[model samples]
Target: MPQIFFLSRPWDDRDVTWKFRRRPAPAEPDTLGGHVRVDSRTKNLTKRLSAGDVAVIDHEDIDRVSAEALVACQPAAVLNAAKSTSGRYPNMGPGILLDAGIPLIDDLGSQIMDLHEGDVVRVDESGAVHRGNDLIAEGEWQTDELNSAKMEEARSGISVQLSAFAHNTMSYLEREQDLILNSVGIPSVRTDFDDRQVLIVVRGYHYKDDLQSLRSYIRDYRPVLVGVDGGADAILELGMRPDVIVGDMDSVSDEALNSGAEVIVHAYRDGSAPGVKRVEELGVPYIVFPMTGTSEDAAMILADSKGAKLIVAVGTHSSLIEFLDKGREGMASTFLTRLKVGGRLIDAKGASQLYQSRISSWQLVALVLAGVLAMAAALTTTEVGQTALGLAQAWFLDIGNWFTNLFR
Candidate 1:
């Protein structure tokens, strides 16, 4: 048989090498005992993933957000048909899985996609996958040492990533300058953010803990709560109703759409709202905001234009790594959006560190009572107090005598 040839680039240098990963999956190892939940789309697959289930996906350079979603599902292992990290920009998804103690079998190729849903398969120590006595598919099982080495290597590409990031910012600014500088495509909302603190929640890193930390803030300020896509479900999870739900409406639940929250469909720049039909079918009245950015950016712009005094963001991206974690060039819009909404917005991801415990009503009442008793004690010890007490006692005794005489 003739050897196969394919061009591949090494992470360190800009050189191509003849390498092939599509060769009939390295003869599947002899093994048999695992169940896999398969989906080519990582996002969709995650929704169906449950504890102890091995997740099979085809995500290349899996980002941090996707990693977190997978970890949240508590999968037993992960099988990827593509490179978990292509050395593009030090993607952390694979590292996150390794940290979570999940076995990540990487670069198994497209043949792995053939495994039907709910099929019983077994993965061996050599990273080979088998079904009954038949060899199915196989790949490299990433270890902490290997993942770290790759991460260290990818760090060298940061300068390139930053340069590209800068270009993206200018590109977005050029296209959406009108939307950013002027209130161009923003729609009017009845939720009324005017003079009120607005809380925008996104389903992102540490969102649960961040939301819990805001219990006091939310109760005290009662800010208009805005949820972006899956974030509406997060709002509902807290037994709180969202004031407005925004996004393409794909990740958000039907219940959130019907929860009396004003629904707004985030449409593409061309005015195509994929979520519009779902809203119509649910009999929920909706407004479409045609924009060129992510739902997160749109929500902040809407709140700012609507006159929100302060915007406390929950589970939103504030760091460079997280902005890059979505693995989309559009994230450049987020950087610009942040600059536009400056001073008005604060990220609550760091809420744990910033959160101050509020004094309870019971404590305040006890303090007041103690103060009153201390004052009474001080009064009794003073000469002027004794005189006042004597007069008050005489007046009370006289009143009591008069009442007794009248009753008799």
Candidate 2:
């Protein structure tokens, strides 16, 4: 109604929720009103958010990929039951929402979660939320200035985060050194990775675009496809089937499990798998993988240990801030899992850059045009073509003469 967009679209954060950070842009409108759609899981909320619906979410330190989803759904505004940026790290999601001209009401507390879905909600300029005639909740109005200030404060905490990251890395290394360094205890997988390139898909950052950029590479190489939970859906959306699906299965769809991918459930270090029951109920056979780190880490280790010639990863976290945005202090360095697979591992953006085609589209088009023109020129040099050209010239000349005679 109010210029309903009057906007503007990535899917899924299975691993390393890092995106390129941008400065916060100013909010376009101070006031917003719409029916509420509430979800505690931000990823789930994004799936159902429609244009003009005010998003009611309970996500703390909202990551960029989730913000992109909310913006894509064109929500009238966003009301958070938790702080958008918890000042643990300078997360890029809130800044992204503001940049898209969506109003953000922050830190309303868990009480705001009580707002009924489909209820008519109003977010006033002062950041007070009201349902009908009664005020339901109030929160901090997130603006460009506040976002910028909070980002600065969050940046200061990075030193502390880094120290914690170092400690976590050491602890993880001590616990999982054999698995990381020796590939011990990796279960037998049906999908062979030996001497083949592997593309491991995750749901963070600019995943869709980054994956799209590798379309040519995917076609040329036909790498072994592995999806981490919701990432399988991403591959499916791109019109390709995943060869293997890996994760806890919490966020993955039933449709993906049914899509015929070899399902591998990420299990606890003690070997208890959580998502096997869901997979079993769907009639999908699965194997369990026990690891001490993130699923993405397990994915890389699997690929590398099985002799994947090269591994390209989409939507993985690579920086300090990105690891912190993962909401775990120990996320830094992917617990040095990269070191184990460093010989073969490449991030999506890096892969896209390094895997460029030998000839560009413009060069190809120009070459084609040149060949056509040369063929036409060669044709004119032939006797038959010359005769045809003369006929054309005579016909035009006769028409010109006829017009001149009529004028006289």
Candidate 3:
């Protein structure tokens, strides 16, 4: 009989340690009767498991990609590997699993990694309990029945958590925005306030590639560049400088401050978490805004507050996947902030749309006019003048035809 094992949220092994320090599951552990252990925060842990192997995962861990991958493995069962099945994040909670008809062993504690592959386990659905491969406990056992109960339990936990998060999120947004209004004394800034094209570039952990691309587009019409916290490092990597560095001031390097960009510190609603003190220690002049949101949101607020003509956002997280990936409580705040600046927000991936190298239609028209004048100048000598006039007329006709064709 195949055995069931509960596992923790698996992590991908390849993600650099700079992201999260990973401890490998022990090969010869005293716990779980020496079950294989793979521990990390990223989904890389999925590769270690073979098909039909049991996996214990947090309900919050189920995303479209990872969920499909696990389901493809055709695991006999998956244990709910979270401390609280409902409290974890990413996707709208673990509701996806309940919908998938997967069995969830809930209220499971450190027993999460106790079982190994090929061990027989029995789940009692009506009783809500698990009996190990040893099967010492007495209970009516049926796989389908237990699977249904597990799904129900998982669904209940998910629904409760999702509703709670939604309510809490809305409340947090209202409270934060109100605080921003009263304390910061600035309205949620609008993107349409400025006509000058400005591109805000962030150089944080994953932004090096995007920042380099932004560098190739730098031109005579220099746009205001804003870096969020450690994004300043990304800016320096691209051989460009940031005009403003905004964030809580924890991750930014010393060199970034002295590099000549102004600094703004994002703080909590009560003004207690002053990110500026550290900057002041470095002798960097900084302003503190006690608005409850990420520094990137604060950067946009500042840009709009100061009247940027057009704001092009680069390296900004705009999608649902990105918001979930950040794993923060302030997502609602950022969401509302964007709504306040909706029309002005252009994606960084579409940065090329703002400027083009080819001469514009207006410039082409001016070039044609200049050529006509030059032809008139050369027409002074009679023989040459007639030749020049004929050529000029032909050129003018061609130009006119091209314009007509262009509009059509």
Top-TM-score candidate index:
2
Question: What are the per-residue Cα lDDT tens digits for candidate 3 across 1-408?
Answer: 233233334322122111112233222211122122232321444555555444555434444334444444545445544432233333422333333333434445445445444454444443132434453222222243443454456544555555654665687667766544433544332223355666666532235555555665655667777778767777777778877778887667789888988777788867775677798788977776677677878877777666677677776766544454355667656666677667887767434334547888999999999998887677765797987778988999999999999999
The TM-score of predicted model 1 comes to 0.78
Candidate 3: worst 10 consecutive residues by lDDT? 13-22
Off by over 4 Å in 1: 1-32, 353-408
Clashes of 2: 3
Task: Give a tens-digit lDDT track for model 2, residues 1-408.
Answer: 122342322211233223332333334445669899999999999888998899999999998778878888888888999999999878888977876667789999898899988999887777888898888889998887899999899888878877888988998988888888888999999999999999999987777778989888999999999999998998999899999999999888998999999999999899888898899899999999988888888888899999999999998888766777778654643749887787677787534444557898999999999999987897699998888889989999999999999999
Task: Rank candidates, lDDT, best first.
Answer: 2, 1, 3
**Candidate 3 regions off by >4 Å?**
1-87, 90-165, 177-195, 203-206, 349-408
How far off is residue 60 in model 2, in Å? 0.8
Position 394, candidate 1: lDDT? 100
- Which stretch of 10 consecutive residues in model 2 shows the poorest summed lDDT? 6-15
Quick one: how many clashes does candidate 1 have? 0
The lDDT per prediction is 0.81, 0.83, 0.55
Deviation in Å, model 2, residue 180 alpha carbon: 1.0
